[model samples]
Target: MGDENVDEIIKDFILLQDDIVIDRYSNGGANGELYFGERKLLSDRVALKFYYYNKDVSTHNEPLILKSIEHPNILKIYDAKIIHQQYAYFLTPEISGGDLKNFKDNNIVSFYDAINITQGILNGLSELHKNPNNLLHRDLKPKNILIDQETKTPYIADFGSVKFISNAENSVVASKSTQIYRPNESVVQNVYNRQSDIYQVGIIFFQLLGGKFPEAPFEWLDDRQKSKFLKISGSEFEKWQFIDSAIDNLIVKNKLLDYDSLPAYINNKVKAVIKTATNKDLNKRYFTCSEFIKDLFDLKKQNKDWRIDNQEIYANKENKKYYRISEDKKGYCLQVSKNQVNWTKDNKHDGTLESIISRIHKD
Candidate 1:
């Protein structure tokens, strides 16, 4: 569908509603569009999400799912309506802080912030996994977690791919989660359950700590292979195709996630928690959201004021030197310190995290 065609659908929706007025377009994805809208009756601005009916995307269950799980850490659904089965539109109070991906990319996520955010997400997941609900958030990624600009609270958003565990015996659906975030079992055996949800949460937890998405079950690939993937010369679509093929090859080999990429500043306890949560072996993974939440709390008690006050520190094991990257009005600033304390800025290495890390060994 073209942009004009989608716009016309939005126009049709506006015509049907008397009080709902879409102010402007916010963003969009493969499934639908998000707009900043207002409820005239309530005098409140809302996030209006409109999903065009498509067989490929399962968004029809989102409204009921949101209504079922009413949580402070979960996105609240105000109202919803289906217009002639062509489009499904819903309203949620606008989250000003945007999604976690943008929040992570733009600012430094401190250990404190990381723990708090992850816990908030787990709290929301607890509601879904507990009795009466017995639901699974089939998709849990950075993009699906929304941040509140004012309180810095994280709210679990997006429920289009949710599934009820109770119905497992009667219904079986193919997993549609993004490939990188999928657990090994989900990718290999088509299993989507509580553990699968935990695995995806583990990936997001790692990203929250290191600011990089882990390529689980393929993270062990040698530097040469990784370098080729990074240096691939092609259009965005072609690069993605190459990535897909690489992931497929890794799946065929039955590889597992590795923790080599995590920064040294992260304590062993934290890493152990992450490893257990994302363990390729379902038996080793946390059995429930409550277990994950308890371990996180224990870590907090053990390391109240995580020794390093600086949030941007990243270590390169090859050089045995610690580096910190900070963002300023000009660009990213890279600094190096043999010990974690004293520092010297490396003027020539100000760029993206990948670029800075790539040059860390050379220095």
Candidate 2:
């Protein structure tokens, strides 16, 4: 639950949570924090985000991410509002227990953990990439990667990570690359291409293998082939060889050598998959999240983690849930949850794609 002024007959939108135990999890983002409640929400015991902003506006891209995505791997956005003049980014199945960074820091992950994240993140991004609308997640980091304790699955958190490409424009370029993202040649060229997302995935995969990067963190190049290996800062580069050797044994050579420091079961095949995925060359990498998923499949098949016994029976359809939100006559909206929709909550122009999608989610 939240301190919402909920005497609403004006909007069809449904709020995801009520006022109960909304507390900050992490000093989320630079200013935001992940909030969890004592009791489950109206839909399910969910997590909510009170995104901070520059001037009394919430900057978290929760609405953008929700607008374009709906998947098991993504933290579901349920509602977004300007309550008490501060932005509250509402989401369903509120994620707790921190992010992937904690898991990586504690080295609490196994091959199963890595594989599930690989699959979930890729599946979520693949859906976003394939979405007819061009939406890019510019910021993908361990901190933004959440895992629900109940399902124990990874959910890509925060929409402040979003970038949208415009079709009407002759030229459009996204903002500067973050320290965490590894830019491909095209992205480095400031081309605002789809490959930027691919580059982000590569960085995440690398972090998955070697933990965190230090100093300058990820490497960015105008060309991956031209730049095979560039100098990086901090203990990250120092540990590169150890990671290199670890990946080499697991991947390229297919040697099932177990690390004295690691569990017995984590061996060659898993390493190889992670290596190829985190490869420096963006072109040499899988272009979309769907293709990247193949690496996990290969790892699972070779290592036997994913199987009929482990996966759900493939059904032709997924359950459909819809909601509504009130926006300015012309603004965007995303279906955050079954009962709530984060309508670009702006009643600006007479219309926005989010408004259109709002209609669809309702239908």
Candidate 3:
């Protein structure tokens, strides 16, 4: 409600070449009256999200951190401004496709569709994980993922609770935006780490596949682990470091339930990837987003239809990347590209199986 803050947002908006039109929408968000704006400072079509200035301003750093990250799957941040000292962000892409949460309640999303969504999120996180600056998305959920109707592309949005690898940079006494997303129920203390973000990804995958939090399914957990999972659903929110890890490890206890009850779309390969990432023990799980992406590619091949003799158009001369065309081979596959790129190429001479995995173990 301050004049200075109002001018800051107006100026930021006007500076935008797209020049967003400001208007508040009564629907959408459950928080204070949802607002809608076109031609946001963030992008040509994306809208601006503004929450009335409450006491917590830790979220004020969200736009700052988002602007620093760039990836095809991640939502693009255009600008950050204040409306009455309240933070507002502008994004580049229009999210008319709707969210995964919306699709679940209305109807069942095909298994293939679910895989694609999981793949996209994994790709985005893969890029973010490599960032040397140490970015951990503390709050990753269905509501924060914006979907595009035409491409069915999902962009990760909402950085209000993002944790920097190192910094008290965004925190202050007056109004930190920490409580909205940061939970106080965990035994481990909070610190940004790749395992932490991976856990959130598992939560996203679980929600999409199950259509809601599996609180009742996991109600058997002790009060501490149950409380942590119910809050943010991971040890990333742990109140203390050493103690939290032990508790999380004990909680996973490999009680993966009702895999058979899952829809046919819930293929075995995809299930393993999701299960490993979400496992309570960080040690046995994918350590980085990059690892998660790699495993996703491997899992994707399981359901793909590819032929060694006559593969489909897997490349364009202009694009450096290529794929092994598949419809459904009904089994496992190993796709080796023709071009210069290769991690396995170097590790395993030329295209020989010697460099790759050795023969199966007799045991």
Candidate 4:
């Protein structure tokens, strides 16, 4: 649990491979500690996830599960082994773009890009659900996803809570970090199924569309309540109080999707997909990953220009630049920024949405 213990354990693993050089510690989450390192012999950068030996079956099964599945959107594991007799560590290629949480907070994800990212996640999830895998990614939050720097592809990472559908009835020890993402059935009955995975992915979809994280007794606060909620944040105790007050003010019951929080530009069809996927009733929800993907893919076919509403940031994955286009009473305004904060006016198009979009692409 201490830093020294981790160092001591990793020292043994490093000795085993003379070329392995531990660069630095990346981060520690509810799952485990991640270290960035490189193999001098192979000239490759890698990530090492260190999990202390525990009774939890998933901790031990993670590496094997990752090894069993092969997909562009899934994290690939090179090796899994017990180290210093106390830790179970797995090696994976280091992803430079970091996780979705950081990316979401920093950049404004475009409409089409959000759909593409969600599709990638669902594609990876499908692999886990297929024949031999039959696995449910119980904890599928933004933090568990890694984004590729070059391609902007989202890779599903963190398999600590992954389990097969056969073990759906088994009680899962939900960490504080994952508790917010738990589906209704998982919370009430200590169960998780294919639908549970669907529920979490739906939440991610909602988030990518500029909606706030829907917390339990999930309902969006009124305009006045939101104004107050924004102002009340300081100490940890105050934060808890804010959360409690927000929950108490919820007039609607069992609302999984916050339709109001979603951008107005989002059509009913896309909203319907999110609603069905995150539906509280297991019967109404998507039964499998393929079912979810079908709806999303259908939407993709129907719409080519999927851009979010005005004033929202859009990151062009091709050039790796931040840009946004907004239509005011006067005309359409396009702004570009290096960092998402300060913007410089790029162009103004008095024409239609298509014309502005054309300027955006050209700029």
Candidate 5:
């Protein structure tokens, strides 16, 4: 739709309600538009989500789900209304800090800050998982995580792909938006349960820590290709082009570094937690979000000073200050303004620092 049409719609929406439209936010997927507005009576700023009448089940159920969920880490729904059965609108507290993706891109979040943000996300997820509604946030990515500008707290938002599994007949509903975060079991066996969300949480945890998505050397294909492969059953997967060879390559490459190759900042115990959370085997993964949070807290307690001062430079690309830690004749030294970090004794570079920063700027 054109800008004028959208503005007219917003104006009309404002007239119909007791809220004043401050400005219109970006358009969302699935025919949704976000707006910043204030309630006339209370003058409270809120984020308004507007959706034109659509047949999508989630579009109709999102407000209901948000209303049922009551947690500090979860986004709050102030009110919802359908106007003339043509538009559906809902209000939430306006978060000025933007989403996690924007925060990760703009600021150099310290390890402690990363932990706090991640913990907030986990806290929210735990609440959702434990809710009697049996909610599953099928779309759990950085973009869906909103940050509070004042407190720098994280809030899980966007229930467009939420699924309820309370009923015995509940089945998985596939979506292209969340293909990258899908667990191995969901892809291969067409099985999705609470464990699947845990796996995605693990991915988000890795991203928060490393500033990039975990990419095993074996994943030669891009996300699109992988999504296509995921649609095929495991029994027939081998028939695809060089599937066996790819799996063999992954196994061989994984043995080289394993999870132990993570940076010195991430100790063995932390690595163990991440490994278990993202384990391909559902039987081995954390059965509940609370279990994952406990292990994360244990790791946090062990490290008195979680902040790594040197790591901060890597995140601030605008400063143009890049450094590589290396050992010279005297002792270990840091080389500044370098394209890449020097390979360690094991011939492994810090992929998180070198690759993630570059990728973020490119994006």
Candidate 6:
């Protein structure tokens, strides 16, 4: 049947179900479409994704994979159904805040907000990486990350390219993965592992920190462009030399001011983290999301006297004392006063503010 006819049938079929299709959300994979919907019984808003059964095994397994995991930062699957063994539908909460790409395009994300969003994504990845079901989100890009309008929290979505690490032997190379965010090892060796996901996260972090992606010469070009360039050049070694030169330029160039022009201390730390995460060697990159989170928190704690201008102040509701933590020329210090604390403690540099707060709360 034609796609138009199939879509019409699916639309009519969905109406018969409990959901009222509000509007078309997006064109999903070649054989699928996403719709903004509302449940008739409860009037609850939802995102309905419909896929033809003949699409691919991954499309059919997407719902099951999502249903297996339950994390706030991960996309929640509300319902699923197979219509007459032809079309499969899966329902999830409608994220009006849209994807990360939209969010980044519309607003100037603060340093703290970037860290928070990246941390949330890392937390979701941690859950996916742990225990019985070791899964790799082979495709982790800004478009696949949805944000909640109210909470401003980011949620990982679109599991169509998810892979089970345990079944690596049986898995085929993901030729369709987004090359911009793909890891070097994966691109060169056709291997997608946990480290590959980490590499994508690193790219996301770089994007969040710097407005533009890291330009590695031919790496930024699409496959077709790269192919044509290589065909004209006739030497793969020339491409490697060009890529190496780009990397060297990035190393020497002072481009940190392009993003938010963050403080030198904060900017250096962020760069260091990105460098480690995006390292070409899988062994050198962050082994787990938890490790990456630790580095981010440590960076947050490392800078002394790093002024967060116009940022929200944290206060203890019970004590009514405003708390501010910052690093200075001396060391890390916590300031507590009626509204803002100016007094600096010179000898309190044991750990990060997060650790200190956790210790104090425990005590």
Residue-level error in angstroms, candidate 1, position 334:
17
Show where candidate 4 strays beyond 4 Å.
Answer: 1-8, 11-17, 54-58, 167-177, 214-252, 304-363
Q: Runs in model 3 with CA error above 4 Å?
A: 1-33, 37-44, 52-58, 85-92, 106-108, 167-192, 210-260, 264-267, 304-363
> Which digits, one per residue and each the tens of the lDDT, describe model 3 over residues 214-313?
4333443457766665566346444344334433444344443345545333456667887787665667778777677677667555543211223321
> Each prediction's Cα lDDT score?
0.73, 0.51, 0.52, 0.73, 0.65, 0.67
TM-score of 6: 0.68
Reference-based TM-score of each model: 0.73, 0.56, 0.57, 0.73, 0.70, 0.68
| Model 1 steric clash pairs | none
Off by over 4 Å in 5: 1-11, 14-18, 28-31, 54-58, 167-176, 214-264, 304-363
In candidate 3 the C-alpha lDDT for residue 127 amounts to 67
RMSD of each: 8.5, 20.3, 12.5, 6.9, 9.3, 8.8
- Model 5 clash number: 0
Distance from true location, Cα of 362 in model 1, Å: 31
lDDT of 5 at 107: 68
Tens digits of per-residue lDDT for model 6 on 1-363?
223544677767755764474645565433377777677778888887888775555558888988989999999998888875678888888887888877877766655567778889999988887777788888987888998766779999888788777743533355455545656655556677787788788778767653465334565444665665667564778766555544444333322223444332245567778878778776788998989999988865553222244442232323444455566564446655554545433234364655444433332
Candidate 4 worst ten-residue window by lDDT = 247-256
Q: For candidate 4, lDDT tens digit of each residue in 1-363? A: 234545565656654766678767754545677777788889898988888866554457888888888899999999977764568788899988789988887765777778889999999988887777777788899989999876779999988777666544533433323555767776556667777788899989989887866544223466776677678768868756665445533311346456787755566788889988887788889988888888988876554344554454253534446667667676666677777688897656654555666655455
Candidate 2 versus the native: TM-score?
A: 0.56
Residue pairs clashing, model 4: none
